[model samples]
Target: MKFCLALLSLFFAVVVADHGDHSDYVVKTGEDLARYRDQCVAKLSIPADLVEKYKKWEYPDDEKSRCYLKCVLESFGLFDDAKGFDVHKVHHQLGGGDVDHSNELHGKIENCAKEGDAAGEDACTRAYRGALCFFKENLALVKQNVASK
Candidate 1:
């Protein structure tokens, strides 16, 4: 009986440990981004059809997709209510103090934001557009960074 109880306690501990908090969702590398993409879709309750479209690089331009992007960005600490796209946080989180790479990426994102009317849209909409732009334009650099790791 004592052995069974000990085994049950260990199982419960392992289960609790595996259930990581929100920070676990943050994507810091290419592999992490890939994993979190599916997790974010499920967590945000994005529809299956939309997920399929997004996987095919087709922007649905819909609210559910927008919300999923927002949730993913928020998990990465890239988006905030008071300061949209917290560049410093993103730099620290994704670049690991590589100021030069961070600056370059930041400039690219800034340029992308400039060509848009994100201010007129809701938070989710803006995040979706920004994330799409970033991924489309800067995925190479991000993947390179992951490779270097």
Candidate 2:
């Protein structure tokens, strides 16, 4: 899935704060992200075929994939049902804690959240939608960041 591929490209060197015990997940390198991905895959019981497809950047629009994105986002302290998305957390992580860059990233993230807003949908669906929008909006920057890493 384009969305999944782009979303995965967003991670770099950042440690998520403790959101009730989610402190253990610190995504400083690709290895840490892979560890969390494995955990989410096992926790959700995602199929081997699906995992393989995802690795190839082919995401299926299904519950498992959507929930997988949600799990990843939550692990990064980027999203939740109650808070929707922690824009500040994401800005800090992706913006490298740069206050001067805050407004630009913050506005982009806010717009994406609005684009993906679905009050009637489930949390996983909402998270997936928002992530899709977020990545699509920031694809170039994400690619640059990924290349740097």
Candidate 3:
């Protein structure tokens, strides 16, 4: 119950904090998203390659859905610790515990992947995908969590 309440509060906070409410910026279709890609590059001066990242920032194409979800979330934002208020940590803190519990046995594999020591970073990366999946599968839950608080 407490966990649920905490989650509710979190969702509302995110909603409130994101005042830009860039609802108008949504990429509803392949072509629509393509335009946004152009806008993002022209407006923000972000590189074309960087914009391409948005497309790749998605759930896995041929792997575990959960794994893909983690990958997507990881790419949502450009996390630079040098910049203040690292939102990346918030996402990580929120979703990692569940992944940790569900896939604990394979924990070392993930940990190694994170540090570039894992046999294959290509195969084991999950933080981003996990977050993306979490948001997609639980958008309502997140909104509720933020609102409650």
**Candidate maximizing TM-score:** 2
lDDT of 2 by residue, 56-122 (tens): 5456789999999889778767788876876666655555444343477788987777655688888
Using TM-score as the yardstick, the better of models 2 and 3 is 2
lDDT of 3 by residue, 97-127 (tens): 2223234433433342244322333422434
| C-alpha lDDT score of every prediction, in listed order | 0.66, 0.69, 0.39
Q: Which ten contiguous residues of candidate 3 have the minimum total lDDT?
A: 77-86
| TM-score head-to-head 1 vs 2, winner | 2
TM-score of 1: 0.61
Q: Any idea what lDDT model 2 has?
A: 0.69
Q: Which segments of model 1 are wrong by more than 4 Å?
A: 1-27, 92-97, 101-103, 113-117, 143-149
Per-residue lDDT value at 129 in model 2:
88
- The candidates, ranked best first by TM-score, are 2, 1, 3
Candidate 1 structure quality by residue, lDDT tens digits, 1-149: 99999999999888777443222434377566567778888887877888888665566778888887777677666786445675545544545543453367667766555433356677877777776776688766655654555
